[model samples]
Target chain A: MKSLIDFGAVKIYIDCSVKLAERNINHLYPSYVLEDNTVPPDYFVSLKYGGGIRRFVRKQVLFEQDSKSHFKPVPENHAYASFEWGLNYVVSNYAQEFLTIHSGVVANNDKAVIFPAPPGSGKSTLTTYLMGLPGWRLLSDEMALMLPETSYIQPLIKPVCLKNNSIDIAKKWFPDGKFSSIASATAKGDVAHLSPPASSWQQRDRVAKAKAIIFPKYTPNKKMEIYKLDKNQGFMQLAENVINLSLQGERGFNTLTHLIENTEQFEILYSDVNEVKDFIEQDLL
Target chain B: MSKHKISSQQLFDLLADSQNALDLSDSDWVDVIRIFRSESVLARFACQLEESGVITQLPSYATKHLANAKLVAQRQVSSVRFECAEILHIAKNTCEKLYLLKGAAYCLASLPVSKGRTFSDIDLLVTKDVLAQTETSLKLHGWLSEPLSKYDEAYYREWAHEVPPMKHSGRGTVIDLHHNLYLPVSGRAPKVELFLEGAIETDGFHILRPAAMTLHAIIHLMLNDDLKHAFRDLNDLHLMMTEFSKQAFWEDLLDLAHKSGFENELFLACRYCRHFFKTSISTEYLTKLANMQNMNQSEIKLLDRFYALALSPKHYLVKRASANFAELVIITRAHLKKMPIKILLYHTAYKVYRSAVESLLGKAFFEKSNS
Candidate 1:
């Protein structure tokens, strides 16, 4: 089935196999996907299984964009995961008009807060918890795209990808949260995706202004601690999370300095979601 | 390199006039942009739009892609200058002059073809005697050759025109240091001194003189078998030909190619440029080239038949059934032109043997998937 998915940032045509589509229990795409075939998608992506001897054995699913295979195929069961990662790769390379920073982002009243963290930092877990608040909006779970020289950060409301133990944690935190079944024994370990709140999709076109930069570090059984970063430290840390900073050249530097100079910057070490939420709700946003 | 089918009609129209892009349907525009991106020539098209002020009139979606590509192109221009400066700083110790080549040279010297141009590695030429010293100096400055198999190392050190590509340890910048113009074992490699004589220094950046550089660009395109980038390479030729089209340029280019035994390559390049891009070639020069390289209408026609299919974007959407046959013809000819029978046979046999072993072991075992 070839369907158009309007990701807000870029519209893509996804042609997927029946089995893979069936496995996507969340119906990941919005209803408008069926109505937009008349307009060509900015990207055309396909997910198909590699046919041959592996068909009877452990099948493999190949992800292609415009019929160009950028990455090797993964096992058949990992199709959805592979597709999401492939989309990430494409956006990171092709979407250079914005200063794309690798982070978990959520917004409140048009003000965006970035949670930039490395893997195993419980970034998505915290982002999921923050959105559970009454007025929080999910900007993106993976990256935040900011227009250069402006504080405007585009909202990309994709499913929140939680890895390993964080998968169960997110599910426990939001009982009514709709999530796909877990994919086990994968490269990033057991993985699941938590669909964003309905309101996030409703305001998908909203561009949030940058208000704060938060770096979260999840320590095992550690009390929540927040530390304010100096101007130099904040700017350098923010630049480290940027995907296309090198490609942006001097404009990237100007954007970062301007952003860090205006926004409140802090690094938080937190294990408790409740404490992190209180800090974001009461002190930050 | 990725092999995909592409509709070259879009590219042909856009290369001739950026305004043609506006006439494409949204679906067709998608294919054209992706193909140009894959071929590393989107920046050129983007440049055309930006320069002609057509960029402002396109849809936001189209304008965004162009805006993004133009930024990438600008970065490449700056990056080339920085990498060249670093190379010169290190090479100045032992090598007297560092002659930039291809994309790097174009950008540093600010040539017309330099607009929206980007390339993978920086290519530099030096005196053959000082090649070892320059390599050592580069090594001391942290530009080390990537680990290659013993056979591959032997190929680069002994048979290849350039040394093993040296990459900066920290910066990850790759540099291809060349002492000669072609594979020495190919029996048609040019003497390094002849090209060096025509080198000129522009604003402290040493580059081959316009005519010699044009001939070198032609040889670089025609001698290579990689049809994947041939279309973009042809466009580069078109830009240079338009920028340097004068009686003096044609005479100087021919004289250099004749001296270097690359007249056949030059003739083929001009023929394809005219065929694909409708590049303006003076009739006087065209006749002179035909006479210089033996006049062979039938052979030229046959090569044209192959290139017509092989040189377009390798996307499957535009591929004909016979494109594969044309590619095989072009590849076989390219390999034959690049190496002697003895070396060519060894290289082919080694590749076949390795692939057979790899397949037996399971080719997927070697592939790394992004998860």
Candidate 2:
């Protein structure tokens, strides 16, 4: 089977098992291999070998793998697209010039800010707000691919998954934003993804050079502050956060050293997105 | 060199064709799909194979694994892709070129799309000369290395196969920086530069070719002091051999081993892979290599037993044997290195004590679970 989707000049062919009717609508041409098993309502998911199976489950679906596979009509125009979109990003990004990072990326002009923080750091919240700014693109809300070699950033324009109270916060913030049906009581607690702004999807493959590495912390009562971290300290912190630094060996070490030496680094403590965005724009821009 | 040793590209093509052509059961088909989709080149190859009528269907399993692999690859590729595009606009931008290694490299060079293999941390290899510089660069971007004891850090810098594993602060990913295929401190230090010189470069990254990589896998299993995960490494070696055997890889195997001072290990690995997976190789050629290495009957028998225990599906007996065998090898090698007699004895006693404690604790835990 052959499926073709045009990402501007790039054509992506997704070889999947089920047909997608919305192919023509979004320029997503899907050539699906017909399968005997029934398609489940919630698409099945699994981790491939060598794709970091340690972090993610090998198989995940709303239902069990052995259970009777059944199809339910996907709610038209939902927040998340087919699972194939996620797969497309994986194939297109791995082993390219980029290093897959577990962080959020949002940019204005070519100047992008990479927010690398642990969970509950409000990185996504900051990213969503940054995307709303004119001329700033939302590269990713969950993962920001850092091209350590060239200090470039790749956009994984997927839905911004919000959890717990952030869901309501996002809905109120972007009243026009679409969202996936809320999946409650997940391992990460109640979760929903803010529909990627249509523009974000259109610029999914846009590469940005990161200007600042901001470690965001959301302490509700803390005053908004953006402190410049020393270059050596920042490099050490960033190295600690990179997914494949060690795997890159000496090159990883060199690449990371060069990246840290050149880029400005900061630690942001703020609950207000507007305050954080303004501070980053003033300091970084 | 025989005509049988295939280039990496040719091997990939063969696997793609085989994946498409085989009339495999669903489970087997899934495995093929997983392999194809985990590596980007493989995925593209599979798609081409499909275009050429080499195989039918994307294989459901391919889609399943691709989803997660895709996510990880996206995270890595997007950053670099962006950097490449925006190079002119950025100031003082130094290119930190990283070569993907192991499964991570396979994702880019071989897998159909990025989603075929679920990856946690992207594994990469760079030259050792730039180790300090690279660590400094990563720190600037909010990544931090895990704190290591001075002794451990010195050990990694001085003699280990790779730098101590580094953890990402934001992503919770681990990166392992390797300077050599095996720990340099080992008694049997193979020629590292020969392997480095023979590395195949792809998409701005360098990687060990199939034969060399296979040998590295063997050395990793045998020499590493850490035995807790020996079986997992053994499984990886088994799977890699099974896949590579389909191609014309014998010549590459022989040439790599002879050049790298690892002819004996190459022979042993081939022998073991064949035993465990029923993989086929040129037996006459392997026997010739074994004879040249002067491997005695006793050594062969011992290696064969070790291989059996390593690959056995039943864990109970195999685990114990594996632990004991690993200890014996380490202790014997220490003695051979001319360590003081008292020090060697102390190390042996320590191993015995640790093994006993672990066994007792393991038994107690198992019993508790059963109860």
Candidate 3:
């Protein structure tokens, strides 16, 4: 059987016969996916049992694009996790309509705050906390899609990917939030996903005006500190962080300049989530 | 080289005639989309269908992908323009004349080949006298040459026609500056000065005139060893012919080729384009070229068979069994024409050693992706 998830900017069709893939789709992506299965998918993804009965004792499953095998086979239990990564691979390569960034985005009052950072920088951890604040919505936890002509960020509305210790932190912060089973010792360390709130999924199509860019770093014992960043420095970081800036070319340059000119830029070092949230609300807003 | 179930021939036929869309099933559209993406011609396919007023007939899903493809193609068009302007600004102080070449020329001149075309490097042609000065000016403007070994540098400087490629430090775009079309060591290398006699100036930049432009495209296709871009090169030739055929382009092209001593390459380009795309040329002109050729009918027939297989789409899905063998033969011929036997052996040895070293150092040393 197949399921379809239309994440506003792109539609993905997930096809799988494995039990683990089915369960994860129902639990982690329920709010964003449509009940109707008729939507024509931009990409067809599949996960099926493989490796024969000898290794099938462990029940390995392979990820496929258009029914052709791709990537190495993983344990069957990780099939659902592999599906999301596969979808990202397709969109990051094919989606030329927007300049995608490796960032997390959360919005308040229809204004978005983009957190562009590296992998171990507590980006997803910050986004998870912001989703709990009043009048706040999660736009995206991994990919920030910025329209090149409009300077607006569209909501991707996928579940947050929490890794290692951050997975436990996410669960403790949002007790009621749903999460998928954790896969241990993977490439990015032990990984799990926290389902986004229903309200964020409800307004997934509402594009947000970009308000501030905060490059955050999690320092263990340091007090909360925030410093204003020069617009040119911000522009350079944004250019380096973008996944598809080359495809956007000159238009991307013009759009990014306009974005930096109008938005507040800052680099913050902190270990406490509450202090960061307070600063965003009382100072930056 | 992942294999696909269906061949690219069907997609090629559909692109050749958009009316054939009526016969494609939904599954066929999937295969066609893959082929177009692999060949980097999806935008061209979409634009052709839209121009024919048949885009409305395409399935909604197919049109969605085409719309995205068009957006990318549009961006590439603008990118080429911006790069050309920047190059002109840098070359203003040092070079006397700069001529745009190949895809950059087609786009800047607003020719037919610019439609839905995507390219990476910008190619420029200048006189041999200004070559050193041009390199110095470019370096002053932050265009740094790639680090090349002693042998490779000598190969480019002493034997190759073009100077070593330089890339802008800030923009990260490559520029290839050429003083001649063929290798200095090649037997078929033409008189480099004749190409400059008739040049067209547009927007304060010079381009090869229509006749020379088409001849250069032919020479590039026939003399080069790389067959990966064979399909795209053939399509470029087809587009160029369709646009230039309006004027006395053929006579001018033949005359230019005769003077440059590149008539054989021009003939091969025309024959292949005609056979593959049904490129329209007057039968009288075809007879004239055929009679002028010193090679007998059997030789031409054999060459046609070789190119027919080699020039067709070489994607994993559409590649014929004989395609690799055909490419090997053509490549050997190209090498033979490029250098004498003694020099060729040394050249091949140096290339192999450099390639092995680059691979061992991992791919980061050599920049690969053109786009």
Question: Model 3 in CAPRI terms: which quality?
Answer: incorrect
Q: Rank the candidates by TM-score, best first.
A: 1, 3, 2
Give lDDT per model, in order: 0.81, 0.55, 0.80
Worst 10 residues of 2 chain B by lDDT: B362-371
TM-score of chain B of 1: 0.93
Model number with the top DockQ: 1
lDDT digits (tens) for residues B44-151 of candidate 1: 888888788777777776777777888888887888788888888778878778888898998887887888887888998887889999989999999999999888
Supply DockQ values for each candidate. Answer: 0.46, 0.02, 0.15
Q: Estimate each model's TM-score.
A: 0.92, 0.42, 0.74
For A1-285, candidate 1 gives per-residue lDDT tens digits of: 767776777677788873864457237555653455555577778888765554545667788887778888787767787788888888877788889999999999988899987888888888888876789889889999888988788877677888988887887878888777677778899878887877887788889998999999988799999999998899889888998888987888788877887799999998888898888778977
Candidate 2 residue A280 Cα shift, in angstroms, is 1.8
Return the top candidate by lDDT.
1
Number of the top-ranking candidate, with TM-score as the measure: 1
Interface RMSD of each: 3.6, 16.4, 11.0
